[model samples]
Target: MSQYGAKYKYGKASPSDGFDCSGLIFWAYGKHGITVPRHTAAQSKAGKWVAARNARQGDIVVFRIGRRLHTGLVADKGRFLHAPSSGGYVRMESLSGVYWKNKIVGYRRIV
Candidate 1:
């Protein structure tokens, strides 16, 4: 897993860099030599769907919010890495957080 706050620091990208939630996932995994789709729906379809109970490091987590789907990378424990629209930077967030807990659709493991 990346350093605790590595998600908040954009090494692969830039702090002022513009990236939506999926953009962060696509870029981070790419830095690690993993090629992922550019969008949440497509990314979700790219990996093998896994049960949340079996999720591990580097897994792709999918969320269903309203009519839109969101995607992020698993960090560790119950934390996940994502570029939130409000935050405007990639950061580690809790899976059990109300925002995510409510939207969690499923998880996908590409590696």
Candidate 2:
């Protein structure tokens, strides 16, 4: 399953009900029987960044979307799994899309 699908995509009032970005990662990892940190910033500090040229499935893609860090899971062909924002649902977004291209901070791989 795509990691984003396991959790709400956007417009969530709480972490449990809906996922922002990192929440999606946390939920997805939990589904695979692994546990990850909850907050985006904290999560960013947890993994080691890998070059996009070497990115693989399940690797974390971090973005500086605004004041906070936004994150997604690497999908095939330069795509990423993520929860976009309010009203957005879990989806696979292109890594080259304007939103992602402009804000991408780094990529990290955990396990």
Candidate 3:
């Protein structure tokens, strides 16, 4: 939660520096001693796949943007937390938006 509003820095995964999409996942889980893969693709396959309806809070949410993948942690009903892109800040975004809704790949639970 502390990362909210932090600057987005590609290839970083810490509150002091900033975070990218998957970087937030890496740091958030690491704070609890969980070892999650450090990149979007690997992290997307890091845990048991769960249907969207069954996906609980904290599940890894994956979405395909063009040929690349993006990731974030599931938030409220239709939102997810992430550091969107360079120059963007960490924040919660609606998953139901036309762009995001169309890009969803799946959800995964690390625990």
Q: Each candidate: what lDDT?
A: 0.75, 0.77, 0.93
lDDT tens per residue, model 2, 7-105: 564534244587787878887777779777888888787767788899898988888865988888887868988887766767898999976788888
Extract clashing residue pairs from model 3.
none
* Winning candidate number (lDDT): 3
- Pick the TM-score winner: 3
Worst 10 residues of 2 by lDDT: 6-15
**Residue-level lDDT for 103 in candidate 1:** 91
Per-residue lDDT of model 3, residues 1-111, tens digit only: 678899999999998999999999999999999999999999989999999899778999999999999999998779989999988999988989877998999999999
Consecutive 10-residue window with the lowest summed lDDT within model 1: 3-12
Q: How do the predictions measure up, each by TM-score?
A: 0.80, 0.83, 0.97
1 against 2, candidate with superior TM-score: 2
lDDT-wise, the better of 1 and 2 is: 2
| Comparing 1 and 3 on TM-score, the stronger one | 3
TM-score of 3: 0.97
lDDT (Cα, 0-100) at 78 in candidate 2: 85
